[model samples]
Target: MTSAPAARASMDAGRALPPPVLVVSIVSSYLLALHPGTLPRDATTTAVVTSGFAAVGAVVGMLLSRWASRRRPHPDTQTRRVVFGAGVLIAAGGAGLSVWWQSLIRAAVGAPPVGPDWWVAATVAPAAAVAAIVLIPRVTAVIAASAVALAAGLLAPADAGADRGQPSPRTIVVSEFGTLLRGELAAPEFDHPAERLVRSWMHSGGLAARAVIVAVPTGSGWVDQAAVAGFVDRFDGDVRILTLPYADVPSWKAFISDDATATESSITLVRELAKVLANRPAGDRPRLVLYGQSLGAVGADAARVWLEDHHPSLLAETVLTAPPAGTVAQASRTPRIVVANRSDPVVRWSLGSLWRPPAYPDDTVLGGRRVPEVPWLPVVGFLQSSVDLLAALDGPTGVGHRYGTEQARPVSGLPR
Candidate 1:
């Protein structure tokens, strides 16, 4: 008789477990349907939707726990086990569905599908479920159920959205030193075939005129698609922008030593550019300008020196924007301009050595009487607006080291 009661109790417990699992799975599925786009592009939309799900889960969990608590309990070990197994299956199913949805979205957008990583969603769900089961008994299963419901609401959908497809941003690869070498040799070409602005710009200018504008990317890795197109469209003269491949070159003896193989590779690039610039006819000899941001500034500075020493007349100007940690000295006999912004955090860290008051006094004359403190966002936005390089030249003024705005002017009386 006891065995019969135990069997009946187990069956009852088993029946109880499915409701929670079904609730969680349904919630997860619903969230997976709403794909929030990637960061910066759809940040606001993602945040709003995520918050909404969290709120709804909290209310539903509370109500479900209250209803479950009032029901008569049965001691059914077999039923409990069955329910637990079912919950696990539901969790696994939800995760699988999320992965499939993400893959489909990526395929639709021409992005590489993300493969199943052990680290993604599989680990979190089980742990959360176990926590809910353990806590519910001690604190009135109603409260525990509510907590689990809320957690499920927040995490299940958030995970689904996190799995949303991301289209790979276009990338251009070139060596650190290879960029200068390319500039020295042939005029740069747009790497991406889809860039309409670059094609249009090239069509407008004849071959000779198009050769003057040199495109210098700032950091390592793939270049930004919008930035590349924007530069091409906004350039007043003939422009050639080269996208360098991503390579890590730390500022250490291993990388920068004169005898280092990497150093040699860098120098070879400069030599190539010098040879190219040297061969051009006087009428066709374009004024070389080095434009670089961040670490690219260092490469540009080095290339400028190499060109001036070997082919002095080729260099017209050097523009260093948000250069890495280094003193900006004369890269060549030609004129050099440094554009810094006040609001850039990275630039501030870089400017620590460069912005000494005693050695590198602020040039008040060039900055005008009132210093400008343009925010980083506006400056970056302005750059993105396809403004002419000449218009982009004037930024904000302050002691801060920013990229887009005119922060601090170079010390006056320095020879151009």
Candidate 2:
């Protein structure tokens, strides 16, 4: 029979190993990073791939844990308890440090500091880390390898389809109907994006458009072209979409400064348009509407504007999809629609940010349930929210932030 020390040492060695799920996650992530062929190399691809890694890691973890349980049952020991305690502390410390780091970064940039979302990340990440440390025996080598592989994935060059050769935003406008509808590019003539949108609106000044939509784009300058197409089709092509553009940051990873710039530009565009449309006959006036998603939605929330006399000509119906639950905006005089999916972290990470059972003139669709004030429960959802954000990209639940063709269909009884 093995001696007590020998058996203990063997069990300890097994406990120290990195979880097989984590090992697979890192490897799969690296492989995906290497093989996203022909897809526009952008943040969406990264989000989708990263989430896939997390999902696989989760599944493998559950299966392995169950199998290990059936092999032998080890009695709880003082040493094991100590190890688990240390891990929990370490995880908590790491999460706290990350939150502090994020705060410093935001302050340095002069942006609104992070809200409850950071707290959620702080709680969730540490718990996850501790779970790995506790469940996987002899995890050092696997952890190091996984880290290295992930680093490789992040550092890899991801530009695909030679996107530099693509057309400018100004050239991508939809002149009439029965043409390309994916509105992705910004108007070219000027360096400032909002100016381009204003000019585009002027170019269509002659049309008797029944409605106009001023859209604020996400960090990547994507205003959901397919969504735009759906919006325009719903309006019977009598509408002109003025997409207010700012810097085309790679993804939602763009700075809060970029968000501020976009918000300011959106405000400028809407104000100018409102000025021009102020004098049109009541029957001939085009209904002004605003659409934004993710970062764009946040910017729209910030651009909350009204005329000197509280006129509603410039701003009418507004649609905000997956807005950050942090910042608060005043209620709009007109119909305000907030669309969100419980699966998206960006929309649910901040406690009290997403208006549960949306009130008043503001109507909200199913984004997520309200965050429980309980200690780490909110944080738990926040972690899942992070992964769900990537899941949102593919509309895995068919009701995520992307909203696809069903985008316009959600706002029932509203004008197109």
Top-lDDT candidate index: 2
Candidate 2, 275-335: lDDT as tens digits:
6687777677777777777777766655555432345555667778767665436465566
Candidate 1 residues lying further than 4 Å off, grouped into runs, are 1-207, 213-216, 222-237, 246-267, 330-332, 348-416
lDDT of 1 by residue, 1-416 (tens): 56988978766756655455334543453343232211111223322333334234434644564677578564245655665576557546655654555455344434455543321323343344334543463454576469679978775211100012321123322224222112111112322321332333334342345334333433222232333343344444235554332232222222233212222233344454455567777667544555555455556566667667777777666656555334345333666665543322323333232333112112211221222232323223332122111122222322222232231122235321
lDDT of each: 0.39, 0.52
lDDT at 217, model 2 = 71
